[model samples]
Target: MAVPVESEAPGGRDVVGAVLKACMLLGQFSADRPVWTLNDLTTASGMNKTTVFRLMATLVQAGWVNRTDEGAYRVAMPVFEIGSAALAKLDIRSAAKPFMSDLATTFGNTAYLMVPAEQGAVCIDLLEGRNSLVVAGINVGSVMPYHAAAGPIVMLAHSKELRDRWIKPGLPAITEQTITDVNLLVEHLDEIEDAGYSLSVSDYLPGVAAVAAPILGSDGAVLASISVGGRAEEFEGAALAAKIEKVCAAGARITRIVRAMPRA
Candidate 1:
């Protein structure tokens, strides 16, 4: 979890108050404006100088933010750890995409690269199946909600942290078929975990069904995931399992390749 930025000593508010205000102030900066002066934060947050300086001092002390030579403030290196850890896990996605592409071409199933972050599996990259109808709805950078989408479900089933963190409450209802009930969803997720993959039919976008397998690391950690998706009507029951072998095979191959290579 990120420590929300805030500062004390401006109005001499309580420690909690300072933390909250600092967080609110830091939230004001982003990719476009990564650095800011005391006046800049004050204007953006509508807070006074006393508040901004105190807050920035706390941030600078905590290593969450830094001061530039020109006297501007910017976010520091802690954020990189989140991305780096995820990348170390998702290296399988880097290795397996091309192999999955071959399977997509062979089976005409759209292949997906699913990596968990911020309580969902982000579709970092994708390989379209040849028929165009193989996997129709999702695209690159599309997010798979924990309940409905096969990628997140499979990844979550493989990750204790993900299952406990994401599959709890407020599961977004992407479609009428989306599962929001915790108990019912848990039963299904349990089955996915036992089976070593996750499967879903129209739980996310309508008319789409997907099968996913967990991509693991060399140390037996659930790294990322891979999925095969097609139209729900055309691919159900027997048809779905028919493709699972190749999907799992591709996923396993991808994981081995990723685990063998040095972290980039």
Candidate 2:
């Protein structure tokens, strides 16, 4: 579980520390806590309050962030729009969208893009299913508690070592439905490992069902996962199996496409 935060001002000829610090400041905002005031940013970022304010002002001017009348900061819409457009052009997503879309349409299930976070998985983007019956309550950027969702397990199943390493620590209970005990979670992971996907009913939120498969990287390691979620009843027996198989196949396809492409 390495935390991959980007760009800490390279130690080369003439580094831009101020710019890098600002980037770090922006990155510090997490899913659990999105809104922050100048004081909060200054404390989290370890920069002076004046510097934090100035940086936030610059971000606001650039439409990357906004300040509420109450003086808390939030990510601005333009920044999200730019990021979404960029992801729309990512080759892996580009190639898999049609396939995933067809699968979602077939199952009428909500679909998501997930990547590994520090010992967890974070949903980055999502598409609501055509049917209202499919659960679309969780938004993009929601952090999936490792115990409940298919996406986390799918991404984790890539390495027994990685999974074993991550799962060893005590699991947290988000709801009464969450599996907090280590041995119980291991049993669930065993099935996930065997099946190449994870499926669960009402494991996180009551009445929410999900299936997820890992997206492997060029190194044959898990890079991300794609998942479909809905009501428990929708994912049972053959229906659940079909959804898992399609999503897992799509994940593998996306992985291969990513592996074939050269890194920037």
Candidate 3:
């Protein structure tokens, strides 16, 4: 039998080309384009038809991809399980759950735990409260931009890199209320950092409101954010004030927990 030689990735790192190809195929499936026929997938990936079929078949056998009755391909349940498992391993998520539950219960809104991502912030966990509607705003795994929502704003306010990216002129407005002006956004970020929390009204999503505070590591770096969000009307007056206080308290508590844990 002829032995196959491994390929070198950039920087002289040896990599399994087949595995990389499989991942490339998997990346094509997304929220907007969840299913793909073999022909379409081949064209979209710009890979040979036979290669696409073989990799997809391997993925199907491994339970990462599923073949539809009509011959289209979509991601399988195991992918979601793997994503959930990854989220579960984060110490911040484990530490913040109790506080998130309390915030949801107390405010009758939704409480969320978000971590900073390269593109923005990712909602890793969520608890819907007593008054949660059928469409209670963003879902778990939703990626929010640093310029828009409360959670990402906390991240942007705390991180110099994110702040630099955000202050660049002509950032797209997520909604009419989203701050697009660089000068005003700079002022807004300063206010959030000064107050130790962020409040947004109809910014990321219309008619939605949220308050969030940053969870900081011992070194003063932001590890994550805890937030509560609901209909804009609910976040007003003394009620809003109470929510802000609770959220900030939750964030502080989680920060303490994170600092005490042994670093991996």
Q: Which candidate's TM-score is highest?
A: 3
What lDDT does each candidate get? Answer: 0.75, 0.74, 0.85
Candidate 2 RMSD to the correct structure: 18.8
Which regions of candidate 2 are displaced past 4 Å? 1-91, 133-137, 160-165
Candidate 3, 63-113: lDDT as tens digits? 999989998999999997775655555587888999999998998888889
lDDT of 1 by residue, 1-264 (tens): 122233343444444676668778777765557888888787777776786888899889999888999988998898546545655656555677687787678767677887878846788778777764644447787776767778888877777777767766776688898889988888888898888777788888788888888888877777788888877764666766677777787777677567656566
Q: Model 3, which residues run further than 4 Å from truth?
A: 1-90, 134-137
Sort by lDDT, best first: 3, 1, 2
Each candidate structure's TM-score, on Cα atoms with residue i matched to residue i, is 0.61, 0.60, 0.65
Model 2 lDDT tens row, 1-264: 112224355776587877777788877764557798887777777676777788889998988898889979998887667655665557755656776676668887788788777746787777766873545446777777666777876667666656656776666776677777787777777778778888767777788888888878766787778888888888888887788778887876677566655466
Q: Please give the distance, in angstroms, between residue 193's alpha carbon in candidate 1 and its true position after superposition.
A: 1.0
Worst 10 residues of 1 by lDDT: 1-10
Name the top lDDT candidate.
3
Error of 3 at 171 (Å): 0.6
Candidate 3 least-lDDT 10 residues: 1-10
